[model samples]
Target: MQPPLIERNVADVCRTVLDDATEDVLAVGPSPTVVDGLVAMLADRENGPSVRLLATESVLKASVSEFTDASVIADLVADESLSLRTSAERLDGPLLVTDERVVSLVTTDERTAGLATDDAAFVDAAREEYTDRWADAESFRLRTPPLSRVQESLEREFDEELAADFERMRIALAEADGHLDEVDISLLAAARNEALLYDISTWGEGVGIASRATFSRKKTRLEEGGLIETEKVPIDVGRPRLRLLLGDDHLRGIDADEVVSVAAELLAAARQ
Candidate 1:
């Protein structure tokens, strides 16, 4: 068999081969442009060949926003005729193999170049390679609308922020020679809530601190160490309840209002 035909116009060759495909089409790459063309070709056919796309996370994400008709892609995915997946590792470029006869290799980066041929052996090799990669690749699910993507990104950022804050608190407490027990950590976490003041007994029990006497002892120690403070607030005809709040020293120069504003923003973004 002659060597595969090398062509610079990758998109055109992909279109021609895809149009001729009678059985199935397998595509592996991170190129949104080529993927877009494949999607368009599949959409135009009345009862087109089965299609499978193996792409990188970045490529999938970009397609959701960049594609002219993402709804059509979603429809294809819903019907099971079109399958999408993401590779665990990056793919070098785009490879398109159709009906186990024609193969196309397209450049993924700046320069547009490709190779296409009806060479059986070359097509077999490409198909086998795609099969191996597809087996290891994770299924790709596209997020709807731009907001869903934004919300996902914000949620990840919020999780990272919370982890960083926990690590910082751990280090700060360790360096200050203030080894916070479980009770202390619980109290601190509760204090970071919107309602800074919490009922000590209720909070302690919720955190599994069980005994009232033990909780009171821990509370007293925290107060003496300048980590927390308490005030008595009277209830209707009942004994005044002690409310716990973070002490001034424990505020770490963070304003309560500012913290609330930041938290609100994070919550809003996550809800979006």
Candidate 2:
């Protein structure tokens, strides 16, 4: 019913929301920084209220970091008693925030879904929406420790695979000084895009809408096939630093087009 302790300051907004008496809160947006703050607040034993967040798959992937104990949030949603829920949009941008007293629904136009309803109706609607979402959402919560272990193993495997591909590409290019066709270079770049850097998409649906297993598998396959390289970068931000990935270095100081032409010339001569 009141303005969401509103502020442009993301941390302050989260602190105010978390400290409030409101037992339930819904945030709709694609900002991972805000979501991470909210999750941190909720994860707090003293200040955080039970929180429900809804947004699109792309937003979640972009925002949620892999380091947080996402399983806790997942467990709360799965419990059914806490009445917390999260939703993901197939598209992008804007988010929705609702509590017992207020709902801030963000939209593509940078406006939130503004709806006026009684507290009772809001709760009922949120609950109904959450229930429907839960049914459709692929499980992002993993309680099975073994599964977590398996996921860790898969991640390592992907990392190794990506490294191998990088090495192979480097060797192939070095043998002929990286003279390759523009088309071939473009193809490799496209493939390189699949590498799962330290960003949130690797966390899968728990952070947004894409299926966790699906994102994980796709990223893993890219890594294992040696098409990418993953590493860790340290930062002093909210969460600890994370592992990241980068595209293969095609060649040092060589223009993309020049490399392609040189490679094509070699190939044509060989054919003759």
Candidate 3:
């Protein structure tokens, strides 16, 4: 018996398959773009089934580029909205099996097309094989700390005022997506509260977000661009620490929500 062919635009095919699943979907042999697909699923809050992404070690390594930016996947994992696992044996292309009933295996050309099968025997066999494989697969863990940990650590390591400012900046720019990186957000949040460079950078590194050198580099860029300024705070310790402050007076008094847009305008003006 021939499985019926299903075709959809490559861009939309995966999402549609995900939406159609009941309760849970096992996605095997995912490509790097799986990050983007997972992000989209996370953004949409509904009764859609939670996803389990199973891939090889090599494929997971390649996906680091996709997960480098703001990690929504971390949040999803924390809330049990998603799961990550790795397979020892090589797996085939993107195969989505939902609730051991419907199986959709997507293939890409100019458009995405795949064979779909609901035959009782085939689906049952697939369910049993994948279940065994999943049980044998090692769980994959993300290096970056969960967003909840990041939130709590910020408030504990720093003052609530600074933490609140940081949270505000994060929520304000949640939809900004790629416009700003974590370094920029951290710097901006720090500037709002005149936070210590060492404190923020240390927190960032401790949470596995970035290193001190990366923070320093971004700090220099912001300072040279006139978006931020820092004053030295003399202490009993070895070296004086720099306290971050918003360089632009206009930025100083504006609401925390305006930081992203105003900073973008300033950066563009500086570049030109």
Q: Best by TM-score, which number?
A: 3
Better model by lDDT: candidate 2 vs candidate 3:
3
Query: Per-prediction TM-score, please?
Result: 0.45, 0.35, 0.70
Q: Tens-digit lDDT track for model 3 on 33-145?
A: 65555556565665567877788877766655332323556777877877888998978767777664554455454455545677778877876777778889999877766
Local distance difference test scores for all models: 0.57, 0.42, 0.74
How big is the positional error of residue 259 in model 3, measured in Å on the Cα after superposition? 0.6
lDDT order, best first, reads 3, 1, 2
- Runs off by more than 4 Å, candidate 3: 1-24, 29-50, 55-70, 78-81, 85-95, 103-118, 129-143, 172-174, 177-179
Q: Best lDDT goes to which candidate? A: 3
Would you give me the overall lDDT of model 1? 0.57
Any runs in candidate 1 off by more than 4 Å, and if so which?
1-12, 66-68, 105-114, 145-272
Q: Write the per-residue lDDT of candidate 1 for residues 1-272, one digit (tens) a residue.
A: 33554444455556566667887788877477777766766666667677788888888877765222454577677666688999868685677677556454655454444455667777787778888888888998764322223223323433444333433443344333223433454345344531223343454454333456666776676666555677787779877776666664435456432333333233344346
Candidate 3 has an lDDT of 0.74
